[model samples]
Target chain A: MAIIDSLKKISDTVWELPATYKEGMRVPARIIATEKLVREMDETVYQQISNVATLPGITRYALCMPDGHSGYGFPIGGVAAMDVGEGGVISPGGIGFDINCGMRLLTTNLTLDDVKPHLKEIVDLLFQRVPAGVGSHGFLKLSHSDFRDLVEQGARWCIEHDYGWNEDLELTEENGCIPGADASKISERAIERGYNQVGTLGSGNHYLEVQVARPEDVRDKDLAAKFGITIPNQIVVMFHCGSRGFGHQVATDYLQTFLKVMEPKYGIKILDRELACAPLDSPEGRDYFAAMKCGLNMSFANRQVILHRIREVFSEVFGRSAEDLGMRMVYDVAHNTAKLEKHSVDGKEKTLLVHRKGATRAFGPGHDEVAARYRDIGQPVIIGGSMETGSYLLVGTASGADTFFSTAHGSGRTMSRTKARKQWHGKQLQHDLEARGIYVRSTSWAGLAEEAGPAYKDIDEVIAATELAGISKPVARFTPIGNVKG
Target chain B: MPYQYLEDIGTADIAFEATGRNLPELFSEAADATMNVMIDNLGAIEPHDTRQIELSNDKIDMLLFDFLQDLIYFKDAERLLLRVRDAQIDKKEGKYFLKAEAAGETLDAARHHQRADVKAVTLHNFSVEKENGGWKATVLLDI
Candidate 1:
């Protein structure tokens, strides 16, 4: 593809497509990936990033993370920072369909050995209580008023309902809640979609996993200790999900609104209709931002409630209280979102709306957004890989702030889920993972097959590239023992 | 011809094209294709529960988008798995309206086997067109 020929090697871990390479690009598009990964990427990704570059108020660079893959409007691993002062625009496509779709890590004092015999029961109990699969629900009834407050208060509301500990909020992004959330902006249909799915794990790529960290996998022992992970085979719980239909509706509502007004009113032209957007200061833009906060908060509460259910299952299985078992949250990161943050642009600080579609914000040390305790160390960035491949833990670095404090979210899909399914049988893939010391529990076997390890880029290479690029510092690596996929 | 899954589409998402002799038949086929993505055995779904859905838009494309999204909303909201049994598409003044009565029972793990949970019908590569003598529309769902 011409897009491949246009890419110029910037460094060992970075590539750039200059503005001159594209017709309407206002800024260069920078990609953080190894040479091999770059070559493997499709031309559609290049076109999408350049399309983002042409948008109004986009500054610095239209950044694509290492796991970058072609997506609807922006590449899945895309990042863009737009200046409101410069008429920065907000695109629902930029924020992604699953708003605040993120990762949350919880550490426990217990190790793999402590739960060896009861592994099946623990995993089974988790799958039972969490309500996995398509169109799933439980008895988490909510009144109209309660639903409104849940979106406004986020995980705090669930904590008040005894779903989790108060400390959980502190570890979550935006303290498990965001400001400027107006439930009035949300539609009744959106509220209804989120009502029954508060604690549910929606299908496809969303899962609750139980993993163990080996001491050998710990890269920074000091940083690992600070995160309450120091021992080999230290059991940890990590969940990957989002706001379910709630977030989808929020994005849908705004995309429709933006679609109707983008060209005629905002005068923002986009190559793909999926990239519909409005100026960040417009009424439509403000409405989406506010509604997105509800989506973000809904996800925060969803994961918090899932965490609560996990703690209860562990407490019951181990015959001890959750706290007694030392089930402490490590950190929660919203890998999908657009937040207003002050970033140094050309050595001058500017408030920008940084949209991290499939990228994680890796705020370095001294940034106030990092937890007070972690302000010195840095924000914890959790990367969930394929079920068979291991995951990684990294901390933001000073050198990483170039792309508005962002890094790769996961091993971007190298192949399509359909290709994966065509290559491997779900039951056979489960057997293969089992042979490799991982347990898989999924509602749909076809879904399980779609997520086969080879379907994604190598986690080790992706993390290595991120570390080498100084975007994030590696802390630890985790291997899954049990995974619950919806 | 009713509808058929577009297997040639990308690996991660799903798409289908529905054809009908008329607008309402096309609407029914589109709904069938959308619901089939969740669970393929339409005959297995007992039509014991019925939900009425009504949507109107100035554009036929948005009307179809709204109709499909409405199915998903009900799926997530009331845990309902429905297929359109009867549908009508009409033009009042300049606005297009769709009214459909779909019948299906609540999702039961004991009965219906689950497939991919379509997050939403994405606008990416989405289109509704008039082809040959009937109407044809293609939609891609973000699964």
Candidate 2:
């Protein structure tokens, strides 16, 4: 394993490795982390990040978010931008298997006190109402035609089906849809795999949590007021999930196809097979992008349906209509994805393909891309911590634009899941969380054990690093009171 | 050979370790294990035509990923039942060059049982380490 020695500290939270550090690297690799966090990283992360720097047409810097971990080709919390017109490459590893796996936060009118007596019931309701665990299927089964429309329409399909509110679409990244999703490009196997899994929380680290809003952390007072979060101790529902099997199949299908086409037709030389790619303008690349968009849309639609199901459960359990109970979407954001955007490079505005594997877009206040409601306050960046810890809602800042308006997505794991299971017992961890008022329900005990608090870095420290790095500022803190794990 | 479940990282994860004398044998064993995680049997697929795949990577682990990806690609795209026939790996200055031959036949649902279509090889908990004898690799396939 190669070690990165003598990193030049750019600031209190930013560190840089110049391009001369490695041969064939087009840009420098920038790591956003504290000294302690940097030291804890496995050598593999360094190798992967450096390899990412060597990618074709990568611009400015190959950036590492605070939650960075050793990934296949690009580190999990990796960010890289390439000039689209200048022969940029699109690697599947950069987008990840889960595609648009992301976080959605919803605020409620009820306070923590109002739900104290029924916390367990609410948790049970969510666990039952939301399909979870491996191979879990939802009630929403769709035909090929319906699935194609869902991919083309995204959350708009859900809204049309009356699964979500129209306003919710406005608050979602890209208005809950990405254009140019060609269903024809997606393979039949990929479509079949996703047919019954849409709206299901297929297993592994995906979860739904019930949280209480902390009074001290509401930074956007006006926005909070507009969202009706005026009272302290208010309860909220936050969940993290994504495109599920559909995304995975699309990624798998395309990665192999890309590898086959990369050398023969495109004349591309790859540093890593896991970083299999094709030029963004190539037929293979365009097809993958279209397929990827389908995955993104499927996830958006899945989440919208899950949100509707949650609303139904809450209404049934609390004896109040969802509208009266204040079940409304605050915002939703995709953490693992690539988007075509305009950014200034060397004082010239250039269109680029920005891949954010485990990073979030944090467009600053007043950006036209931001929703009309949140344009004045910046985009809401949801950072989900481990189930046993607290999640934070942050707003994008001006400085974030320098890095294409992106920030760390979560706490990032400090220990591997295998290591965590070996070190701790799931049942014991469940007991401890319950003792702390966090009701835990999971389909698999072993899975729960792997996500123990110790497996992850402290989210507070990760958020603090982001704040100090001037990428995003904390808007609110939400401590989980109950959680459902798939 | 059978894959023994090592541990679970979360709800759907089950880690396993397998061993073989050579690259082809090791990949065959690993594929059997991955399929075992999803279904019951791999012995059902009939042996058929040999397919050749030549891949090169800067690192051995990536070569492993590509090797497995090729099998998945064949299974999904070509709808064939693939099993490793032969494999050779050469490494120099950190780069791994590989040539592999695999065999697969037409899938008969009555014999070959289809399980979850593995979506992609995940970076989550992916590893390839050299052991005292040959090479030991661990990967998490997103199913």
Candidate 3:
């Protein structure tokens, strides 16, 4: 309570903890949220974000987005930019275990009425086609070498292999493939763990859903139409997942490497073991960066393949070709990543390594990084909510530079998985949801119970904070009609 | 049961405490806690297969860390659900060494009532210590 009281309110939606709040901090820490959300935030988030402030090369402030919650070394929704030339370091904790763990949205011309009768059929087919749950493997079985190729080429490889449309790449962040990925940097064990996991909707909060946007839900009808939400009761498919075991292995392998040398060789002592990092210029850091890119690409390919599967299911259930149904990609956004980008620091533009763990990159309008087609409208930001509550589609704002152009990724969890499971029975919840017209399918009943809407913070409030802060603007809200939970 | 899931910590992940009378027992208990996060029914995992594990680390904590990571690796790589059996830990020349056997069957979703997927072991608040003349460990798993 004392810590919360100490926060200096900068605005109704922004609070700052001065550099003096903790010892060894190089910069202040900021939490972007309304007063109520800040009051309800877990205490660990403050400690974690403060710890992030102490990392070398952290510039401006260590920030937590509106959906901030307790995570490992960096709070979920944490954002920190390191001055690469000023002793900035790259930490695996800042990037997260599920590298490039992100969201992808696809728009279809079909309205709610057209999809209502076949919701269950479409969801069931997707559940089977897109592997889900623990130890689940994707349908794409690649050899060790081909798997290496896939990670390097990313979604481009999927297109070459006939898993996606050519346009899908243009709509993906970084064109679905980032540069500097080297398969040789990845460990053999990591390869073994990730090779068959290209298209899986891994368990523990990963999911695929069929959502609808009613006319009233479109807050900015013109903006929503520009991003493919043109039809009333428009049907859209969105899924949250990442590189699976491959990316986890990549982060694990690098974290252990960094921990071994962070203090001894690099002289970088971290407050928490999970915050292990190496200087951006160090051999260890460069190697991990290259390897992390592989993980990033792997996730792009994973989503690309999953999109192909979704198209197949929709076409099958509706007895029409995917193109005929107007299945076009809205956008794909990665929630966890570290990338080098130029931004204003001290009124001078400098290249900084921005780390967004459990946060989304929200580049504003006219930025070259925005896809060419979307340059005039800004980048699309997909924010996933709990399966039961629905999700939102937002656009980056010019004023988002306050946090280096980062925003909340999801409705951050408010309860632990065990507690949620104990409180909600998955079977009963499923039936209850079905009665409300939201058909549900999951790999495990217990996993379903853990994701009950009550376990998470209010998504609308989180979005409202972002808008007030001028970080991103909401275009439309989507209510789920069918879901495939992992 | 030697292990119990911790409710107050790791709101976004799974956390648990495992206790044992010795290092070997501590490692085994910790392994069970990790696997339990993925599969709810440990008894349902039959010993239809076996894996031998050998690892060593200068720090006792990392020794436990490496052993638990090996189990998760097998699960993701081969879909093998395992339980620790006959784990042996010894310290020589200030370095800790672990040797063990793990047994279970390849995961069959139809038979094994799966739970949340445990991504990896996080070092956040992860510890191995002596408590009340027994070895105790706490682990938080990224899910």
Clashes of each: 0, 2, 0
How much is the lDDT of residue A164 in candidate 1? Answer: 89
Q: How accurate locally is residue A279 in candidate 2, as Cα lDDT from 0 to 100?
A: 87
Give candidate 1's error at residue A473 in angstroms.
1.7
Runs in model 1 with CA error above 4 Å?
B1-11, B91-95
Q: After superposition, how far is residue A360 of candidate 1 from its true place, in Å?
A: 0.6
Fnat, model 1, is 0.52
Q: Please write out the lDDT profile of model 2 over residues A162-230, one tens digit for every residue.
A: 998888899788888888888998888777667777677765678899998878867667666655567
Per-candidate interface C-alpha RMSD? Answer: 1.9, 7.0, 0.6
List each candidate's DockQ score: 0.57, 0.14, 0.87
Worst 10-residue lDDT window for candidate 2 chain B reads: B5-14
lDDT (Cα, tens digit) per residue for candidate 1, span A1-486: 577888888898889999987777889999998898888887778888988898889998999998888777888899999999999999998988899999999999988898778888998999998988887775588887798999999998988999988889999999999998889999988888887788988887788999999888999999999999977889999989898988999999899999999989977888778889999899999999999999999999999999999999999998999999999999999988999999998899999999999899999999999988899999999999988888988999989877788999998887776566678888888888888878888888777887888988899989988998899989999999999988
Stretches > 4 Å off in candidate 2: A1-4, A217-223, A226-228, B1-17, B21-28, B31-119, B122-143
The digit string of per-residue lDDT tens for model 3 on A1-486 reads: 578987999999989999999999999999999998999898999999999999999999999999988888899999999999998999999999999999999999999999998988999999999999997998887999999999999999999999989999999999999999999899999999999988899999999999999899999998998998899899999999999999999999999999989999988888999999999889999999999999999999999999999999999998999999999999999999999999998899999999999999999999999999999989999999999998999999899988999999999999999899899999999999999989999989999999999999999999999999999999999999999999
Identify the leading candidate in terms of lDDT: 3
After best superposition, candidate 2 residue A448: deviation in angstroms?
Answer: 0.3
Show the lowest summed lDDT stretch of 10 residues, model 1 chain A. A414-423
Candidate 2, after superposition: displacement of residue B63 in Å?
A: 12
